[model samples]
Target: MSLEAPVVRGVELADDRTPRPVTASETVYEGLIWDVRRDTVDLGSGTVRRDFVEHTGAVAIVAVRDTPGVEGASQVALIRQYRHPIGATEWEIPAGLLDKEGEPPLAAAQRELAEEVDLTARTWNVLADFHPSPGAMSEAIRVYLARDLAEVAEADRHTREAEEAEMTAAWVDLDEAFAAVLAGRIGNATAVIGILAARGAKEAGWVTLRDPDAPWPAHPAHR
Candidate 1:
């Protein structure tokens, strides 16, 4: 059987979900946070088996504030934490998994910001959304741009433990963060995407941003 190429109609680029017939599926591994699954699928051409991680999705925040005395400049909040997989300390924005059942993405971002950095924001916008590695993982992340910042009250702060207890927070100029991303200093997927997307949004006068509670169809937990 010959497979015909799909027709293209417009210049606007977008991603669509393509569902294939899963002939067989099974949970290969179940961990504390995520699970691995192996599946046999029919891709029109033939049947193939693959293993992938099943994720609960997550949310990230690019908390921003205008630079004092620096016209048209902004600063972003960053956190440095030790990532065991990479065996190195990496810089990243405030983020957390969508493990809580029925909680919205905006609320998760808000909670992460306060928990990770002890900060809160009055304004929020959907900066960007993406799947870091679709081939091997079903993780989708939404990065939010948060402004009008204020510190969370000490009494209401979440207690940090494990790796989080050793995490450090800092405020860096957005431009500097962008430069760091370019220079290979900041390697976290969420941080790189958020910094670059935030810079682009800022250059466009933030007219491209969406509402904080905008529809996120890509996240399985939300959808």
Candidate 2:
């Protein structure tokens, strides 16, 4: 007996802001993290100018464990840190920018895990990839699933400074974290996506997990 391929209907997505002919472009400001650029784009309807932030992209780690290898709810590592831009302390997962030249997203996530939480993981999976704000900025963030964790020694751990210096961390159950995301208690975008994605992946027996160093086409750094 022969089986035919199932027909999958493609959704008709409309994107009015497709990349148009750039008549003019220039950098407006350069900051420690990102750069602001002004561009004149022709939308076919008319020409409009706007300023946007050009980012290098970043990564977030959902450090989780489930009795090492057993199948069950896992514990997630979370952090509370001061975000000066928002003027409020927020709960989030360990994350950092892909700042280093030629550094991969997974490497950045691993570095953030060690730097922020003084922890390392033996198993890593790609959880979710998203654009924090595509309309205003070119910032794409990839969140990873990290397991088989181990704490760094006091002597080998990085000396936290700046925003990380005041950060506090805790381990929360996966289901509870998901509840927090649903309750609007977790405001961080990466954290919220990571928690919900992790739950879904867990329910699917984690068979849909991608490689840790999976190719991220949306990440400008990769481009």
lDDT score of residue 39 within candidate 2? 95
The deviation in Å at residue 131 for candidate 1 is 0.8
Worst 10-residue stretch by lDDT in candidate 1? 1-10
Write model 2 residue lDDT over 1-223, tens digit each, in one string: 3378665479764334346799999999999878999999988999999999998888999999764464665889999999988898999999998889877777788899999999999999999888999889988889899989999988999989988889999988899999999999999999999999999998898998999877777764563
Which structure among the candidates has the greatest TM-score?
A: 1
lDDT of 1 by residue, 1-223 (tens): 3368676687788777667999999999999888999999999999999999999999999999999999999999999999999999999999999989888899999999999999999999999999999999999999999999999888999999999999999999999999999999999999999999999999999999999988888985575
Worst 10 residues of 2 by lDDT: 11-20
Q: After superposition, how far is residue 60 of candidate 1 from its true place, in Å?
A: 0.3
Report, for every candidate in turn, its global Cα lDDT versus the true structure.
0.94, 0.88
**lDDT of prediction 2:** 0.88
